[model samples]
Target chain A: MNYISASPALLPARAGVGFKPEHFGAIAADQQPLGFFEVHAENYMGAGGVPHAQLRFLRERYALSLHGVGLSIGSPEPLDRDHLARLRRLCALYQPESFSEHLAWSSHGGVYFNDLLPLPYTEETLAVVAAHVDETQTALGRRILIENPATYVRFSQSDIPETEFLTELTQRTGCGLLLDLNNVFVSARNHGESALGYLASFPLIAVGEIHLAGFFDASEAGAPLLIDSHGAQVADEVISLFEWTIEQAGPLPTLIEWDNDVPDWPLLLAEAMKAQDRLRHAERGYARRLDRRAL
Target chain B: MTSVMSGVAGDFAAALRDPLVTPPAMLSAHAAPAASTRFCVYRNNVAVSLIGALEARFPATRRLVGDEFFRAMARLYIKAQPPRSPLMMRYGDELPGFIARFEPAAEIVYLADIARLEAARTRAYHAADAEPLELSSLAALDPENFARLRLAPHPSLEIVESAFPIVTIWASCTGEAPLTAVEDWRCETALVARPRLEVEVRRAPPGAAAFLEALARGMSFGEAADSAAARAKDFDLALIIASLIGGGLLVPADGVKQMETIHGYLA
Candidate 1:
């Protein structure tokens, strides 16, 4: 049975925020002018109760995006068919406007680590990720987006760059990219790479959505190490990068993700407004470019 | 995948579990002065996230044990038993047993039972939804057939019996009573069920646990009453049945074709 009201065909190319339980009552009481709200798909896999109830209410009112964290799409082991089936069932129930998962692995050898563990970008890894994405898209009967992961260490034996790996996956499986700008910044800083340089090589045309979140900065032996903690507000550097990304890509569905230490509703809404402002700025810039071309 | 890549993944996992094990040597040392310090980031993430899951699942237990004790204990448990499933909601099922065997927590004898109750509540919150059988649904049944009536328990129904007053302790953690104020400590049975949207945890009356447990195992109503009566001399069958119906603990048994028809009609 259809669980949500008829929603738009795609999430509006505007600003959204990660859905947290604390804000459920507030969001329900007053509909914020949000583009959409995103939730971790695993949180709603439960058979019944508040999570589903709140999700149903939100799905009826606003556009919804089901972003998954536990798909383990980059694992060496065969895809977990049971987990995939559950995800398929959820997608059928909600029919979310967008479904996305990370380009990282969480489960290996049947043990699931809670963190999004990084993987080496290699030909073998690419083949595995592409096949998994293909399987996921086929099972769900919709194209999925794969987000880049924040990494701490790189593999010495890896041959392919992160952008190349994502591009190859998109080409092979026809999947889109969920460009997490914060993760790009975090991984670049953590690995001593230039964030802008990474963005220059990134296949922005394939980006279907954008994620901006906060990171924690710690020094390991005096070198800056950025962790994707998602505990605080989006950093200035990340926001600047987001603006540049929107300038390049001409506005996509952007999300402000504050999963840990979630703020009060007004604070969260303000963050979304920031993203919305950037999106509108991009729109205006794109309009001016078109006007120039016409001139 | 290449053996080298697989080996690196395996070693990385091992190092995360055990801090003493050095990070896999294949890690490219581009950013940090020491790869080990960088590797600690993943280790910290795994520990903190798993601990957070446990904390959410067993808030009362964590409160009773204090934050430092809980975190240290949770870290040990994480090392010994990581989650086998990607579902975070179902991550801490093994925690109660681990706490039971944990040496440091031996002083708090009732802690494990409290954890069990919390876990049961978590499970009930996520269990499948079902429309409960109303008390009036049984009106059409003949008095003679009442003895043979087989009742089904709700999908979320869970009975947790403990030697310590786990219900009072759990309730105390929620501010119903202070922990030190629990003077009369006695064995308690908790009936956790999600009759509707909100999961309710109530103290089951004397002998009610036995009655529900028997019925949950497919015993006839008369047989379950007898079992409960045998366990507690004060077992009042009528009162227990009313409580069960009120709490939405009992459903129409699938084995009874007539009951299914009746349930359909009620629906």
Candidate 2:
């Protein structure tokens, strides 16, 4: 099934925030300045209820994005056909501008761990992940953005840099990247690598969207590890990294994710406004470049 | 193929639940020997988040037991049976049954019933929406025909029949009412349903559960009411119908469901 919306089915190059039910009444009352609203696809998969009701209301006003966290696209097993069908139904009904999932696996052997577990970036995993992505794109009949996972451990499996692995997967499957800046900083700092170096190697041109969120510092560990706990505000370093990526990529559809310790409406809106500031700054740079080209 | 893929992913999964099993050789936490938080982080997120989902679903149950006691018991439940559904909202289907057998929570005899009430409410919140049977439709029916007509229960209708006053406990825990001692220590049946947007829960009248159960089993209104009245002499038919309308428990009549008895199916 396909749906053609009045607006283009693509995320605008502006800031968005994840939709939470608590802010439903607030968003309904005031027409906030936001590019889009993203919802975890699994949470709204029920047959009918307030979730559907609220999502329908949001879909009418905002450019919605169905962000999936449970597709398990990185798993070695075949994608859950039932889950893929549900995603298809959701996309058809909501007509979201964009849909995305993680580069990590959350389920294996019929048990879902509810966490984005890491994978070894070997030649074998690359093939498995690419094949899964191909199937997912085929199932949805549209491209998806795969977000990079924040990890505390590095796999000793085969020789493959994370950037090269992601680049090859995008090339093989013709999908886009989510480029979570917090994840890049978290994974790189944990492994004693440079976030700038990782971004330089990242496939920036194919980024359809970007994710900016906060992390918890497990500084007490043997080596510093940052947990991708989206509880607090976006860190200064991550906001800085997001600015750099916006400079390079020219303000893609950025989303502020405050899933944990979800703040009051004003706090969440403030977080989105923070990203909007960076995007507006990048927008000016793009317009200046275009004017220069016209000259 | 399963084994090949499982070789790495499977080993990693096995280690998540069991801390004794170290992170597979495929992982290196900063090249440190015998020291790292890699595996622990994943384990912690899985446990904490799953427990959090449980806590969200069974808040009244959690409030009844203190946070410390709830978390400790929830931890045991998580270890024994991790969620089968990827959807977190549907994660704790087996929890009420789990609580029924738990020794530590055994003393709070009504704890399991409260868990059941909460679980049913969660299901009702997500249950399929249907237009409820209008009260006028039933009033129009002839008294003779009304006895034979069977009403279809609403898709979201669920009843928790308990020996304790669990509805009061749940209402108190959820702040719907202040905590108060139950003057009557009689059995109670709680009906949970979502006819429209809101999910409503309240005490079901005497004999309503049996009547509804029989009605659900495809018994005619007359037969079900007869059984209920015979079992409970104080059964009031008007009150039962009123409760059904108020709770949106039944939709308009369709074909009467085929009755299934103990021995065989009845047409």
Candidate 3:
């Protein structure tokens, strides 16, 4: 059905904040125009409610994106057809500008773990993920963006790097990349890899969205390990990486996430305004480059 | 190959049931027992995530027991009752029943009801949205015929009866009401509803509770009022009716009437 296009026409590069229920009144009454708003798909999976109503209101004023965290794309068990159908229904109802999931699994056997869990980068896991992606696209009737996960530990038996694994998934299934830069910074720090190199390795041509969020330094045994808690301010280093991403891939629809100890709407909107500043600069840079090429 | 994959899937499933012991090392392709470690990670994530979901849905229950105690009980709960849905707000529907039979905290006989209140609050939060009936709609009706008329509760209303002063406990713990010196806390009933998007929980009169319960069971307004009056010296029909309507507990009967008279209309 192609509910979401691979080359979808995104809003002119700008920043948005996650749509939290607490800030709904402020966002509704405020005069600021955000580029869009992103929400955890599971939060709105209810048949109807305040969250649904709030999302319906916000959707009219701004572009909406549905980000899912518990699809368990790497599970060996068959995809939950009911969950897929619910996602399909939500897509039909909301018609979000973009839809995305993680490159990790959360459930196994039959039980669901709400957190995004890491998977081994191997042919078997790859095959499982590709099949799930195919099934999800078919069920959702649209292509999806798969976000790379932040990990605290790495499997000793991993055959492929995270970038290669994500690239392979995109190639085989024609999926797009959400390219969470803060995750790149977090996972890189946790595993002692260069964040810049990791960002450079991303297949940016397929990049559809960018997520910038805070991280917690939960180093175990004095060794630096970052937890993607999304609790605080976006680090300056990650913003630099975001800037580099803008230079490399041009500005995509970026999102600022603050899921824990959520601040007031103005605070979140201010953070989004920070990304909007960067996106505007990137947009002007791209325009100038295009003008120069014409000359 | 299909049979082999299914066997492997079954083995992995069994491993999840008891993941403490060392699993077979060949599950990972690079051969360092990464699958076991990954499985351990998955187990930890599931335990923590589901436990957190429960804690969020059952804060009053958590407060009744301390955080540490709640976490311990929740771990036991995760082992016994895994979530069936990814929509986490719906995860702990069976928890009240589970707490009733749970051995560790069974001494707190009222713990199950407290858990029921918490679960009801969670359900109310996620309940379907509806435009409430205006006060004038009832005002337009003849007072004589009001007793025969049925009032449909809003989609988000839930009533619970507890043997402990659960309303006091919840209010004190959530800081909704100022704390007072402890006395002999009496048994109480609770009414939960979401007139707006947020769910509200508060104590209810026994009469009102009984009335709402009957109405919830599809009783006519006259019968439910009679039931309410049986429980109290003065079940003020005006107060209860106004309260229910004001709290968005009552919906107009148009939809139900339309459904009931469908055959006649078709004829």
lDDT of 3 by residue, B194-235 (tens): 867668886675478778777777777888899879988857
Model 3, A1-295: lDDT tens per residue?
2233546336446788888888877878875668889999988876456777888898888888899987878676788887887788788888998889998766666776677866667777788888899889988877898998887555544678889888888888888888889999987776667999887787888888899999876554645656787889899999999998997767789999899889888788888988988888988898888899899
- Over the full model, what C-alpha lDDT does candidate 2 score relative to the true structure? 0.84
Which runs in model 2 stand beyond 4 Å of their true positions?
A: A1-9, B2-5, B31-35, B136-150, B219-223, B254-267
lDDT of 1 by residue, A1-295 (tens): 1112222126899899999999988888887989999999998887777888889899998888999999889887788898898888888888899999999888877789978988888888888888889889888888888899998888887899999999888878878889999999998888888999999999888888899999998864568888899999999999999989988878889999999889999999999998998899999998898899899
Candidate 3 recovers a fraction of native contacts equal to 0.37
lDDT of 2 at B104: 92
Docking class of 2: acceptable
Error of 1 at A46 (Å): 1.4
lDDT of 2 at B106: 93
* Model 3, runs deviating above 4 Å: A1-11, A220-222, A264-266, B1-19, B22-48, B182-185, B207-210, B213-219, B223-239, B254-267
The order by descending lDDT is 1, 2, 3
Better of 1 and 3 by DockQ: 1
lDDT of 2 by residue, B146-255 (tens): 88877767777898999999888889899998988878777788999898899999899888888887888888889989988988878999998888865678765452
State the lDDT of candidate 2 residue by residue for A1-295, as single tens digits: 1222332228988889999899898999988899999999998887777998899899999898899999898898889888888888788878888989898899887888998887778788898898888888788888888899898777666479999999998778878888899999988887878999999999888788888898998765455677889888999999889888888768788889989889999999999998998899998998888899899
